[model samples]
Structures are given as C-alpha cells and as structure tokens.
Target: HEAKINGLSITEVDFSTLSDDEAMLKVMMIDEPEKLSAAIAQLPASLYEQYNILQSAPFFLEFLHTDSHKGIGVKAIAQQFGINADEVICMGDAGNDKQMLEYAGLGVAMANASDDIKAIANHITASHNDDGVALVIEEFVLNK
Candidate 1:
C-alpha cells in the first residue's frame, strides 16, 4: 500500500528457495544493476533473467520516527552507531529535539528552549549563541 501510494515498484524476496549462488547474484544485482547485467549475460539464459529483475526495484527504504518531531532520525542514528541510550546526552532549543533530549541519560534544554521541552529536560543550559552545547559538555561530560 505504501509503495502503491508513493508510486514505487515493490518486489518480494523469498530467501528459502534461493541457492547460495543465486543469492550472491541477487545481492550483486542490487548493488550494481548495469554491471550485474553485463556479467549475467555470460551466465545461462534461465539464470540471467532470473536475477535481472532483482535490481529493478527499490533497494532501501528510509523511515523516520521520533519522541519529538526532530528526533525521529536521531534514534536510528544512535542505534546504527552502537551508542548506548544511557551514555548519550542531548540538548536542544526547540520542540523537535524534545524526544532526543528525553532519550539521553542527560537531557539539557537550552535556556531559550520552549517551556514544554525545558520541563522535560534534566537541566537547562545557556542559549545557543552562548555555546550552550559546549557549556553542558564541559560541565557535565568533561568535568564529570
């Protein structure tokens, strides 16, 4: 439904029946369709077309979700970087950063932050122009 709404072509992969060589070819096709096509031409006719369609569909989808409007992608990045949620610290001046601020072990809202965000943070720091991020990092992260 999402793909249909977005006008994207979708293909489903059934990994159970694919052989090792077929899987490898599929992966290669996804990464480099043109190159894979040239190479596949040298393979048997049945296998050539079998793997060609693999590259014709979208290879990746990006999803964004956040505790606050702006923090949606932040969680994904933290997970990708292998950073522990407890070890992370976040500071922000706007509502979008609210979720990131709350997710971190130490959440500092800018002195200029919205009241709602400030209320949810562990502390309030200086405004952005005053180097709020630097001040908090020095006082809590470095000095600690």
Candidate 2:
C-alpha cells in the first residue's frame, strides 16, 4: 500500500526454492527494525559462513555470497588496471559499505554515517546532501 501511494515498482516472487547461485537475497523496505534484527539474530551461525548478511539500513538486509563484496570488487578492478590499492579512496555511509571502506587506503565515512562506520573510517566528511563526494575529491584527489 505504501509503495502504491509512493508510485514505486516492486515484484513479489516465491523464494522458497531459490538457489544462492541464482539470486542474491535481499529483504528490503522492512517496516519493523527490531523484529528484523531479532529474526536475523535467530538465524544459524553456520549460514553466516556461506553468506555476507549485511544490514545496509535499519530496514534493509542483503545476503550475498561470502566471497563477493564491494572490497573484493574494488581490489579486482585496481589490480586489473594496474592501480595500486594505496591509490584508492573510498567513501560510504552504510553497513553494506563496511568492506569497501576498510579496503581503501583512505576510508571516508559520511558525517551522517552510523557510529560503527565512523569508527572504521580514516576520516569523516560532510553528509551526502552536502557534497561530501565532491569535498573528498577536491581535498584528497585534487589536493587543492
């Protein structure tokens, strides 16, 4: 109903038989954060070994293969293009971004990011709405 009111597009699918190879499970736009957290906590510990279960937001959970992450992708691209890891700069503001932020030579968290994100970041910049990306590029990349 909320989606309808907001003119959003969504498709409901039966996931009971979905294979991990076929899909990366995403439970999105959850209305109840506490219940979702409780349910996640109840999941088997062994399941975590096979998947990277990321709570991207208070209401969003994403499950992907353990071997797949933003960090891995960034590393792969850097290696392929002959760009050193020490030359890479990454920024983010969500739990899903944890890996990439950690992998970067300079990890920048948005000022509006969660506490845990800030804890892992090398620096904290302005919020997304305040041109945070531009600021990082100007100061760190352009160095002027």
Tens digits of per-residue lDDT for model 1, 27-138: 3233344655465456666653343222222332111221223345667778899988787888876544666787787889888777777899999999998999899989
Per-model tally of clashing residue pairs: 2, 0
Candidate 2 structure quality by residue, lDDT tens digits, 38-91: 878888999788688877777767777786778999999999999987889999
Full-model lDDT, candidate 1: 0.63
Q: Determine the C-alpha RMSD for candidate 1 after optimal superposition of all C-alphas.
A: 16.8
TM-score of each: 0.50, 0.80
What is residue 59's positional error in candidate 1, in angstroms? 38
lDDT of 2: 0.84
Give the root-mean-square deviation of each candidate in angstroms: 16.8, 3.5
Question: Model 2 — which ten-residue stretch has the worst lDDT?
Answer: 22-31
C-alpha lDDT of all candidate models, in order = 0.63, 0.84
